[model samples]
Each structure stands twice: as structure tokens, then as C-alpha cells.
Target: MPDFLTLANHCANPRQGTQPNGLPYYDGQGTLTEEMRWLRSFIDEGYLWYKEVPANLNMADYKTVLDYFAVLKTPLITASGQPKDRFHFTYPSEVWEAMSGAGVTLGYGITWSRSTGATPRVYVVTMVEPDSPASKAGVLRGDTLVSVDGADATTSTALAALSPTAAGQTHAFALKRGESTQTFSLTSQKVTEAAVQNTRVISTSTGAVGYLQFNDHNAIAERQLLDAFTTLKAANVSDLVLDMRYNGGGYLLVASELAYMIAGPAATDGKVFERLQLNDKRPPQAPQMFRTVSYGLAPTSLKAGVTLPYLGLKRVTVLTTAGTCSASESVINSLRGIDVEVNLIGGETCGKPYAFVPQENCGTTYFAIQMQGANNKGFGDYADGFQATCKADDDLDHALGDSSERLLATALSYRANGVCPATPLRARSSSSTGPLQLLRPVGKEIALRPR
Candidate 1:
């Protein structure tokens, strides 16, 4: 007899269907009957596991077990939330990672049909890029995803199962827009945004400094960072003031690149970038490291080395808030490991350190276990949430004036005279185009936000 999981895997990845139903029919050869019995047992075990879930396990652990079994049997459903059990599991974390990694804009907005009278739905939009595959496939805003391939994914699990590999995989999406339901096929492609997001820059009021911000890191974060550096160097900006107040973490490599850039290229000669510790608390595989090239010690080259590079930052003043999370915190914690000046300000950050990767089981999508420990400087679990070194001291309604104004002002003071000022920087402009102007000038309390 085949192993339980082996049979399950075979069931999930069956041979070509002989007829209308996608399932393989039972011949008297006994293979089909035995497979069916194994599948039944597998389902029964999963039910038992779900029912026997330990009370002591945290939500994350509980979720992991539930997810492991879901891969064995993915349930499919139709557009009206109909049960379409032809598919496998749904909501496998890997699907979420792959979709987001492919540069899709994921948000939790209420998706409703007029007939359903507003049941909560997760709204996914394929925002167009200059020349991406999604744009090429004619996917646009207001287009609702109904299913991937022939699998019905009307629920969160179904949605997660649509994770496509790479940017070039062909994805068939059944969608709804306005009042019409339709289907379209498109090759997954990376979206390139003209605006920069999660990039690092340095301007000098007295000396070199840091200035970084990002619109999104899903696609071209690495490119944006390179561009920002080139522009800042040309403009003779010094030091650095990283602006990640709006960044939601995306590709892990991009975050690592940012860390390498800020750390320079010399300090990271075969050093750890960060570690991923599973719950078992075993020492993570050797910390992933990156080398730097050009500038500082090696040569005054803006280009970085293929291997380890510099990892030195005199002082880092990270401007953050609640929007900061995951890869964002990874970059921050990595920098802190080498003793970069991390003046955390603005607000608290969302704590998520587990890195995720996708693995498919017979089109029943799932995530591979790929997270690490939080010993980035032995400063304890950075996931406990890093509080602002300078917490805001004003009311919530006055958020703009209180949090940002105060944070930026203190950062400027520290850079200018190595100490915070008694008063906060006043606001100047609030125009969407003028982000830098929103904060007071780097060295002085000159309100820059447009009125």
C-alpha cells in the first residue's frame, strides 16, 4: 500500500482525465479503489487534527497545521460562492506571497455584488504598469477575479491558490466587472512603477545623511533605490534620513539591497544580513549575506560588488509608523545588527518576521516553511515591536502636525547639532507631490509642506 501522503499527492496530481469529469475513473485494476480509500483516510485524519488542535499552540502554530492538511484537499467553489470541490486547498500562505511578489496590488476592501447585498469580499486590482504582462493581458482596475485555471476561488483560500510562479506563467482568470462575468488569459509579468518606493538617499545640511521613501516595493524597489542614490549623489546630498513611513514590505531581496546600500560595502564581508529561525528554535541556516562594491573603502564606485560589501552607517534615523511591516522591519533589524544609527520615530510598526515561499501540491497551493529567528544583534525578538525612540506627544486629530512634524524636526536637530530641539518643526505644505516639503528643512525648522 502507498503511504497516505504519497497517495494524496498522486490524487492531487492525477494523470489526464479520460472524460468530462477531471477525476480518474476506477477500473477493476484496484489502483483507483485503493487511492480512494487512502484519500478518505487522509481527510478523516485532517478532520481529527483540526478537532484535536492543541490549546497551547499560538495562532501562528495552529494556522501552520491547518494549512498543512488543506494542501491534501483543496475545495473549489463558483462565482456565487458555490461549492466547487474539484479543486484542492485554499488560503495557502504561499499563494498570497506569490501573488504579491508578482506585483499585484492586494488589499482588504469590501467586494460586493448588487444581488449579494454587500457581503465582504477581498478586492484585488491589477494596476497597470508601463509594459507589464498584466497590462499586456489587458487586466485593469474593477476587474474581479473569479477563478484561476478551472479552480473556483471565490473565497480567501481560493484566492490564495491562484499563486503563479514567476512573472511569465500563464494564468487564466474568470472575472466580473460591473454586471458582466468574463474570462481572460494573461502571462504574469512584473509591474514597473515610475515613482520610487523604499529607496535610500543622502543629503548634506552639515554632512552626509539619509533620505529614503517608497510608494511600493512589489516590483522595482531595487531599481528605485539605485536611481535615488544616483540622483542624490549628483545633487550632492549628504548623510541619510530613510523615509519608510508608507512602505509595506515586498520582495525580501529588495529590502536586503536597501540594507546593503545603507551599510555601505565594506562592513558586510561575509557577514549575516539576517536569520530565519523556525519555531523549533534551531540555529538558522547560515545567515544570508550580501557583498558591496564601489564607494567608501573599495573604490569610489557607485556600483556594488556581486558578493559581500560595506555594512556601515554612521547614524540611521528611520522614519516609520504603523504601515511599516515584514520586509520593512527585516531591513531595519538587519541594519541594527551592524550598529547603524536607527532613530526610530513617527509611530509603531506591524510585527511580522516570517518570510514565505510558495509550493504547489497538485494545483492546491501552499507555502513552504521559510522563516527564521530574531537574533539580529541579540537585542531580543525584534518582532516584539520596536517603539519610537522619540514617541509623539500630541493628540490623534492633529496627527499631521504632531507625529510627522515632531519626528522630522527632531531628526534634523540630531543631524545638525547632535541633539533634539525643545520645539517641534512646524508644517508647511500638504500637497501630494511635495513629500520632502511636508517636513521642516533638514537643518532648520522651516515648514516645507505646501499649505
Candidate 2:
């Protein structure tokens, strides 16, 4: 690895020319102060909002520098000055390597969301990865977590126990299923998430509806989606319902490929799936077209070299919630750009139109908002997020992909009648319902991992 100055200079946007203040950038043996000076200079020169920042700010340590830099970056702020940059953060190299490489983490393999309540009492299971300890322990989506190790599951201690930092840790869980409660003792392990959770062909009165629960857009998801579409196509399904309520987004290529699969070659041929806009200092990027091939985990690798399977559907129903974001929104945006009908159900998506390329400096990987994605029509400013066509609650009482699930059922109802459900499942307010805790930790959506 190069020195911090060299590494910073190499990729920092608006590369530093002579200092604007005409001060010597740094001249020392890389002391703490010198490093801070180098970082300050880098940010002062390259930050999108450098001019708006105060010239003198306290920088006592590395963490302070990061905090200060975060405050100075202006691109993250909305036009009215609200902070809109949740995607900007830094991670240690090892953590970044694990997340970007395999999407595995030390936990029990359950992605959960808290139910709105005053006192956190139930954690609703949103996704369960295949072959994980939680899955092997019979944990299913919609299961309500009541307790952990005899303590209220919503308590900080129980939540901490649920996500053990070390492998081989054991935790007992009490889950509520309908009227019955089940208990399971699960041992924490390294869990690799399966991006494609569930796929099936539902026999509907209208026709066969392909139901796919797409959780993430990781590299493995590229192949899993291809296989799922191949199965759907063989089943001769007429309509598709894509479940992305809990998906927080991943690679842009996977997003593009998914759009390609939903809209076949004829519909997507020579179309711009997504166009990336960099900062004013950088040159414009070429549009990312619908892909027909799957790439390896090494994001740039084409070693797998398999042609993507297509569904060639005219319309798709996408289930969404606040968790749906980034590349996930891209799928909805790009498809709509090309005139494909996308009917959204559930809550509004997490508004995120920006992406980042991980840049390493010293031992920390920085994920800064570097580019904005737009559709063919050049509409991309969705910072407030896309609203659902048919408003529906994420029914925690029913399993995802189940015919009776609130969001899925609403979508099915809309398909049959072309009207939104009048009285969708209503969500309980936090005061009325006990506080529900989110057990699983959320990970970053690294658009492109450095190989």
C-alpha cells in the first residue's frame, strides 16, 4: 500500500493542486498532526462542499478527522440543508473484506425488523438465510421473537446476545407462531446470506404468478435470479411479483441484470438501464445497459460466463418497505424508464439514488457518495423515495410469499381488479403495540468492491 498522501492523492476527487490557502500541505514524518493536515488538505481540496466549510476546525485524532470530514462534505446535504447522506461511512479493512467478499457475518442468520411499539417486545423475522443456524433451527419469516435467554428480546442485552461477535456462541430464543410459542437454542455461526430467499409459481385465477423474494443484490444473487427466472419461464407464468421489502441493495450490475430478466432482450435491447453522474470535477460515466451474463464475486470477473435467463414479462409487482433502497430502487426506476409497468406495494422505499466505489486509505475503507443514478428519461432525484401504488403494511403475522401476506395479497388483488385494496392491513402504532426490536444488524451496500 502506498503512503496516505499518495493514496489520498490518487483517487480523491478534485485532486489537490497548490493549496488554496497557499500553505504547505504537510512536511513531516507522518506524525499524527501531519496526517491530520494531509487529510484536512485532501478534504479541503476534494470535498464537494469544500467552500461552505469553515477554514479552521479542530482535528485531534483520526476519528475526529473522520467526524470533521463528514461534517464538511456538502453533497450529503439536501438543497434545504438537511443531511441526506446515510451512505457515507468508514469501516475497518477486515470488516469490509468480509462483507464485500462473501456477505457473511458473525451472527445467527436472521434479518429482522422491529415492530412499532413503546416498549420493545417483539422482533419480527423479515428474512432467514438458507443453511444458517437460524434457518436450521426452524426460524421462519413472520415469527415474533418474544424472549432471548429468558430476557425480553427487545432489551439491549438480549439484542446484543442475538448478534454475537464471536462464532460458536449460544443463545436461546422464544418465538411466537400464531397461538403457539416455540423455543430454540441456536448457536451463532458465520452465516452467508442467500440473496434469493424464496421462489415459487402461484396458481392464481388470472394465471400463474411468479413470486420471488429477492433480498439482496450480491454477486451470488446474479446466478440465483437467473435460475429462478429459468424456473419461472419453464412454469409459463404470466405475471411476476418481486418481494424486496427487506432488501437494502447491493451491486448495480445485479440490479441491471434483474431489470434485463424482468424485461426480455427485445424490450431491453440497446436501452440504458442506469446512467451514473459523477461530480462536476470528474468526467461523465457511460450508461450501464441491461446485462445478459453473470459476473463472479470479484465484481469485475466474467469467469462464470453464463448467459442470464429472461422472463420477458410486460409488468412486475414489486413489494417494498423502508428497507428497500439503492440498487433495489434502481430496478424500479430503470424498468419504469423503459415503459415497463412496475406496481409497488407495501411501504415507501428508502430513498437513495446515490452510490459509492469503496476507496481505501490507511486501514479504513471509505464509502463516500460518489455518483447519482438516473433512468433513461433522466429522472433520478428520488431522495424522498418511491411510494407504493397500493398501500399495504408489511404483515408480520404472515410469511413472505404466502398468498395471504398483506403486501403480496394486495398486489394479487390489484392484478385481478386493477384497483388498490380498500382496507389494507393496518399497522399498529408504537404506543399501542409493544416495542419490536430489530435483531440482525444491517450491512453496507458496496456498489463495487475493489478487486
Candidate 3:
């Protein structure tokens, strides 16, 4: 096989210049078939489950490059009966750059919760980014989506309308929250995300408990976390509830920093937070150590040499769901590795200890399981995901960070007492609803991150 670079940069629509990330494009003599071959060889060499990928998948049988790439992943199943390699996919390189960098995207800025594999689908807004189109329209959490563009929300046509298109494309949405129904003609546009939100000190009888909704692990997250930690430090909060139910993960280092900030130097100063283990054919990797100081990495973060504020707590409560993935899972596992108890609430995390550095070739960025992660103790076998300590529905009726919210309240109660409630909360439903549903993000299915 030829070197992968020899077959790269053969875009059908070859870019005219460099991208916003300053990646330069070059001309290539490569063809579509050569590009496909490059991918086949790349996967054979780099994928963690390289041996499980079918040996007989002839590239000629596929029509499009995407179709060929789709069938290249392992067909193996996990012990949990789920597909072992569900996180394989690709993205337009530019789109990934914006998201991994500043957490910006084109959308209504509403993270919705949809009932998976349930008939007569029900979708609810779990979060609305402040100042975005969804928030400007006064859309709130707990608002059940009834219709899109006058069609039933469950229908394929209506659901397609909600897919991201371009800025200024408008769609009508009918939603019901409790007894009141509201409709919105919302437009899609570039929405800069607030990676961390709803940060506040919840004054409990036990002490000041700090809580913050962390939605992404992008570059901007570093600064926001520093600011949030600073606030929590000033309040001297005794406990912390990190809400990561919708975070799909980003940079691995950002996750390590979060773990350090939670556990502090006493627990993590000399320990590894997470170690990336590549496939058998690859070289050994250096473990990702717990970061102690801030580099002011984000475009708008504090200047270099600023010390990070840590909670120095031995225990932390994390709010989670299946939408909590990759780097988010790393934070939980790493904290637990150092014997810093992570009491989880909500649902189990999306089981994915694997990560891959995005590789851009021919204008597309590819994601594959190149490495699996382990915590300090070198244990990384939670494929089915970390189970919740207290099973509580995400209470959308009360805004996130509110003390009455189910997940936060449960965390508070669990900390007060070392046990879960007798009966856990479930998503509220009327007789008209289907099986009990849990809050899951309507955004990307898996994490987009590096290890």
C-alpha cells in the first residue's frame, strides 16, 4: 500500500485555500479508488478493532466513499449486547474545527431529549442555550415537542426539518409545557455555546454545595471551568455536582484538568488521570497526568501562569446520562481511580473509553477508535458504562441548578445520607405516554474528542 499521504488531498471539490484553522490544502494525483484504498489501509493499521473488521469487504462493492467507510468498522458485540463499535463516523473538517475549538455551531441551541426505540416518539427540550434562538423564543426545558412545520414531531419529515441546514432557515415548532402550548418560528444560525452554565452555590444545611452544568469539553471550556472553580473556591463549597448529561466530549486534556480541579493535588498531584492505550501494532503511550495549572489555552481565557483553583474534596457528585460520553466518562473514571468517590445521579454514562484524533484527508475528518483509555489504576473495563448511584429523572420542570431539580436534589440528599431514595424519580408522564423514558441528548450520538 502507498503511504496514506500519497493518496490524500484528492477532493472532488478541492478547497481553493486554507481553512479557518490554517490547514493548507495541496493538489494530489489521487483518484476516488485510491482514496478508498488509503482509508482501508489506514483503518487496518490504526483501528483498535482492526482484526474484527471483515476481511472480505471489497471496496468495489460500495458506491460512495461513505458507504465503504461505513462497513469498515468491527461488527463485534459487547458483553452488554450493544455493538462494540458504534462510534465510527466522519464530519466535514471545518465543522469539527469550530466545534472542538470554541464550541460554536449552527443550530437553535436547544438540546432535546428523545425517547430511543420507542414508538410514537416524544421529544422534550432538556436545555436551551442562553441568548440563542431557542432561548430568545422563550423556550424552556420540560417543553414537549408536539410538531415541526405543522407536522407531527415523531414523523420523519418533521424530524428532518429540525436537522441543521444554514443560518436563517426558519421552521415552526409547536410545543407543550404542562397545560400551556406555545409555537415558535425559529431560525437557525451560528450559536456560540456557553460550555459551562447554571453555576451557583446551593446553600444546603450540610454546607455550600457548588453546582454547574458543563455541556462541552471544547477549548473554551478551560476558561469557563477556571472561572467556575474560582467561584466555588470563594464560597468554600463542601460538595460539587457536575452536570454533564449533554456533554459529548472534546479534548482529553480538558477532562484531566477537570479531574484535577475536583480532586486537587492531594489526590492527583503524582497520579495519572487517564492513560491512552493504542492498538497492539502501535507504540506505547504516555499517561495523561492530572494538570495542575492553567495555560489560558482558550482564546479568551486568563493569561498564562494563572494557578487553577481546586476544591480539595474527596468526594464529588456528578449528574449524568447516556449523553455523557468519552471525555466526560474519563473525568468520572479518573476521579474514582484516585479513590475520590464519584457519586453519580441521573442515568448511566454512554460507555465509551475509546478516543481518536481526528484525521483530515480530502476535506473530510474521520473518527475511529484508535485508543482505549484507563484510569490511574490501569483499569478501563466499564464498557456498559458507569451506573448511577441514585436513579433520578432529569427534572426539566425546574431549571437546572435549582435545588428542587431532581438530579441536583438527589445528589444533595445522597451526600447528606449515604443511601439513595427509597423510590427514584422517573420522567413525569401522563396516561397518554409510552414506556418510561430517560433524558438523552438529541444532538450527536457519540463523543467527538481526542485521547
Best model number under TM-score: 3
What is the descending TM-score order? 3, 2, 1
Q: In model 2, where do residues sit more than 4 Å from their true spots?
A: 1-55, 61-72, 75-82, 178-182, 298-305, 427-431, 434-442, 445-451
Worst 10 residues of 1 by lDDT: 442-451
**Which candidate, 2 or 3, would have the higher lDDT against the true structure?**
3
lDDT of 1 by residue, 261-330 (tens): 7677665556677665533323436565643432211122233443432325656777775456666777
lDDT tens per residue, model 3, 135-249: 9999998898999988999898788766667888899999997888899989999989998998999887778989999988878888999999999999999989999977877
Q: Tell me which of candidates 1 and 2 scores higher on TM-score.
A: 2
Q: Which prediction has the highest lDDT against the true structure?
A: 3
Clash pairs of candidate 2?
A: 117-430, 119-435, 120-435, 121-435
Reference-based TM-score of each model: 0.51, 0.85, 0.94
CA lDDT, candidate 3, residue 131: 96
Assess the local accuracy of residue 389 in candidate 3 as a C-alpha lDDT between 0 and 100.
Answer: 89
| Model 2 accuracy (lDDT, Cα) | 0.74
